[model samples]
Target chain A: MAKTPIAFSLNGMERSMFVDPGQNLLDALRRGVGDLSPKYGCAQGTCGTCSVLVDGKLQLACITLAEAVAGSSVTTTAGLADGSELHPLQRSFMDNFAAQCGYCTPGMLMAAKALLDRNPSPQRQDVVEAISGNLCRCTGYEPIIDAILKAAAFMRTRGRP
Target chain B: MALHRGRGFACVNYPIGMNLGGDPSQALVHSTPDGKFMVTLSSIDLGQGMKSVTRQIAAETLGVPVSDVYVDTADSDTGPHCMGSFASRGTHRVGNAVIRAATEARTQMLQAAAEELEVDAADLETDGEGGIRVRGAPQRTISVADVAVAAQFKQGRTLSGRGIFLVPPSEVDPETGEMSPVTCFAHAAMAVEVEVDDETGMVRVIEINSAYEVGRALNPKLVEQQLVGGAWMGLSHALYETTEPYYPDRDHLPVDFNTYLMPGPGDVAPHNIAVLERPAEDAPFGGKGPGEMCANPVLPAVANAVFDAVGVRCDDLPITPEKILRGLRANGS
Candidate 1:
């Protein structure tokens, strides 16, 4: 199989890696770079577990080709927190119990965080629309909504840095 | 949501939706304005045990007798959701989490107290919120509040506790299409009453009532919430939910909630008060899942209810207008 050279910035680090032609960015991250936060759920581009922030925009890493992200920035769930201290949304997910069987968390967090980062104080419907692609069987989507709202409230309290 | 067709067939089933391998928060150890926030989370509260196990573990840890603790399973990262998604092991999984976290806090408090008093940690007793009076002394006392504060300096670390448990929870082999492939069963029984339209063939939902063996109710209100939520989800799977992905090989036809055909308030019948029966072997406070369980029987119950209402036994799911008409035709009515 022919290989393609790819270059991208991940979690604030600039790096270059050779990816197989059939490999998606998610595969490269999980297998090549050793980032396991993004899971292999449906691999059908349906479940949002493989979501990542591509150049500040939420995109499915499972579908994006590794070669397409050259010079682009990719952020995974592992990039969201500062060591053990979690992101506000991550912390609120703990507080509200938003996630269960957290396979969807990486994508959910990425999507919700992207929305929140773009619009710090999103309304309830906004939160709903934000995570429409992610599927969570645990919290019944209620606490997930509550956590986004709670995280918004927290961000507002913190002046939304 | 599984029905055994044959007699004497033992079944163990895991929930279909709950994928066990992921990280969510289960316990939070922090000092509140008036007290400490010590929480215990089940695998995933998912609107089921988010708040209940919090209460049970807090009550157990503080020795406040389960009344004083308040749980919120609002977040997922810091807590743990269960091994799978059945809404049946809410108590078992979260109860174990509650035990682990609360027990950790309990040990830390008693050990800290022992350190201060220069006695064996084994000799001390805990009363929930650091209400540690001397085992025999009438005057010697250590309030929960004080131990919590002192623990910050003594333990040299945040006293947060966490436990990750994959209970395997009723294994239903999706690959093989096998249900009840395990030894654990969080059984629930449901009943519903419906009204079917003969002319237009529209079966408007009338009312639904369900009962589940919840082992024990850590939070009774949460159990009701789970049942209500599960009932709605089950309704979709039975009557509206389709396992078949929409056209276009990858695009989920049910892309949005609107097309997903999930039940709204208008489409849903009033969740008649669901009765939660307590089982013995669940947890410290006897809690189990009610959300997913409540949904399992909804389709069948509605089908059964429709059969009762219109004298038709529909084998296929979703008892839609077409299915109802077919059911009517099959019944020769």
Candidate 2:
């Protein structure tokens, strides 16, 4: 198949890649642009492991076309850190032991970031609803929920990172 | 006609390690020239913290700080032999192997320190802070790093050790058909509360409380993770998950995470866990594996809860709504 060129702002860096026709954003990011944070959990848009923020909105990269977000800015878990400093969510995840196998961490963290970006002081129910689309088999969802809430509290007090 | 809440309890005693013929695990402990230790093993950690637990075991046996030891479970082909990580044997079997290997390495480290300190090997003790010293006189001490350098460059000695742990298979008498399968057992008791809707035949697990005797938790946090997540899995098995929903027909099998049903985050209940440690004599550091048995009690507890709520005996797995409704109709309630 002939490849189509697309350009986008990924994690605050300008990246351009030649992608096959109808390639999903996940493949383009992982293969073409080399951002491996967005994982491929379910390509059918069920598990949210491929979730990324496109133009500051939560979108499933596995279902989204790479061409659709040509000029838009995308963010993934790989971009969550600032050089050596970790995002508040990452610290909270570590402190709370939110991840076990960590296969679902990227998407789960993206979902939580989207939630915190919108509502900085979400209730426990909101936290549950935010990560409802993502599936984590190891932590029983409690520690992840606790981590998200803790990050929200920290972000609210110290300003979002 | 309405929602009824009921509570049910169940208990279990689960065996440790595989019952097959001679389940074995091996480890190789070696020291770097700078005194850091690396433990090599073929065991795999499938999110059960095998690497972390074994590292702690190695450090403990070597009388070194935990940070000085690193467990490298690089690959099965490159490392020592292991029976793999099923039957919750990774911690128990692999941990014992690590203890043995680290003990041997510790002996070598002490001998090297003794050579430098001009003291007997038996009189030299690890300070547990990266230093080796005379047992009674702490002032006469040598850093483990210096000892490693001397042992390698001065003495031309290699500081390494290998160990393997095996549980010999038990033989069954042909006539009586009895045998000892495992060395020790982990015990647990759980009580589950559920709400059963008589109209929709729906069951919702509300709360769970359990006590586990895990034979000395090597890592309490890891044990808690296992117990909490294991209970969720048990809840999933009791009500939500099924690869083949319609049995005997072999149709509409779930192919992906969407169709393959599991309890979502919203479906979770408050779970309270109490861990009891009795310290098994034969266990590594008197610790048993907490991987497999934490979910066993939930299956029967949920079944008993359903029966208590709606007076239906859901003996089959997944305790689906259709089965509960059928049982209710047959009861003429």
Candidate 3:
């Protein structure tokens, strides 16, 4: 199969690459764009470790084809921070000790970011529902939920997006 | 048409380190010209904060600030030997080795400082701030960096230490089949409450309360994470996870995470944890590792809860909905 020319905006930067037609968006981001934060957990979209935002919508990168979203905006955990300073969610997660083993952190952060983007002051149930797709083997889901709620309050005070 | 609630409890104990064939962990400690120390060990962190705990141990032993110590767990080939990070032995075994190495290195540093001050080594004490001072003489002090420079350049003494910890093999009585395998043991007790819907034969865990007696908590946060994560693994083993679809005959095995089921965020229940610190006599800093013990008691506790809920014993690994329904029909409940 011939490679197809695809272009997209990634982490606020426009990138173009020749990707295989059968290649998934995860491979395009990790191999083509040199973004390693989004991990390959199950690679079948069940673990949600490859979660990323395409056009401000949450989707699994493993199942989403690269050619399908030729011209779209993609956001990853690496983009969550502003240079050296960490984002509110990252700080809250660190302060609350939300990550253990850290394999599921990137996906959890992306899912939480999507939730807070839609509903700034979400209830506990709303937080649970939003992160239901992501699976974390550590922290027992308590601290992760607490971190998201705390980040929401922190973002509210900081007047952040 | 009724939902029955049941409660169950279990207590378990697990050994700390590997006992067979002599489990050994080695560490090398050396000081830089700038007074900063580095400890190189082959132990892998596995994201369990092994580096942080070992660094703290070395700093405490060397009478220096924690920030002054850096642990390099680079690789097994480059550093000293460790029996890998499993059996919850990383803290107990590697920490002892680090303490021993740091203590030896501290002795060398004090001796070098004594030579620089022209005082007896016995009268010199470390100030825990990279400084060595004479006893009862507050103003007479020499920086550790100055001592390191003199020890290497002037005295031709290397400011380094090597240590290895090995548990002696125990003699087993063949007739009695009794032997002390490990030095220390960690204990835990767990209680689980669950609701069973008779119509659908579905079980939902409402709450879990657990008490663990770790020999000591080197880092409290790390211990809590291990306990919570371990309990979740126990829950998975008791209810949700299974490798074989049909036991005794491998058919339609799960090849991916989709086919294999694990607990999601919604399945998590309220967990209350109590940590008890009973210092072990022989352990390094009285710490008996609590890594692998977290998942032990959860299995039996949840199994007993299912039996109590529907009055049916599930000896199988996963007490799935199909098993519970079959048990209910067999018991004619």
Tens-digit per-residue lDDT, B156-251, candidate 3 = 897888989999998788999888788788999999999999888888999999999988888888888778878888898889899995787899
Candidate 2 residue lDDT tens string, A56-112:
899999999999988999999999998999999999999888888889999999999
Q: Each model's TM-score?
A: 0.57, 0.97, 0.93
What are the candidates' individual DockQ scores?
0.06, 0.74, 0.63
TM-score of chain A of each: 0.96, 0.97, 0.98
Pairs in clash, predicted candidate 2: none
Q: Kindly indicate the candidate among 1 and 3 with the higher DockQ.
A: 3
**What does DockQ come to for candidate 2?**
0.74
Residue B287 displacement (Å), model 2:
0.7
Query: Which parts of model 1 are misplaced by more than 4 Å?
Result: A82-84, A118-123, A153-158, B1-124, B128-133, B138-215, B219-229, B240-292, B304-315, B325-333
Error of 1 at B51 (Å): 14
lDDT of 1 at A94: 78
Worst lDDT 10-window in candidate 3 chain B: B282-291
Model 2, position A69, has a per-residue lDDT of 89
Candidate 1 lDDT over B1-333, as tens digits, reads 111111111112234123344212244444443335546343444445555555755676556555446665545555455444343544555555666676666666677666666677777776554477677773677766666666676655444555544434455577987654322355666666666677656766666655566566556655655666666677667667654443235565555444555543235466565464655553545544454556666766777777777766767766667776776678776
Report how far off residue B42 is in candidate 3 (Å): 2.3
Model 1 C-alpha lDDT per residue in residues A40-97, reported as the tens digit of each score: 8767687788999999999888888888898999899989998888899899987765
Which regions in candidate 3 have their CA more than 4 angstroms from the true location? B115-118, B129-132, B142-157
Error of 3 at B191 (Å): 0.9
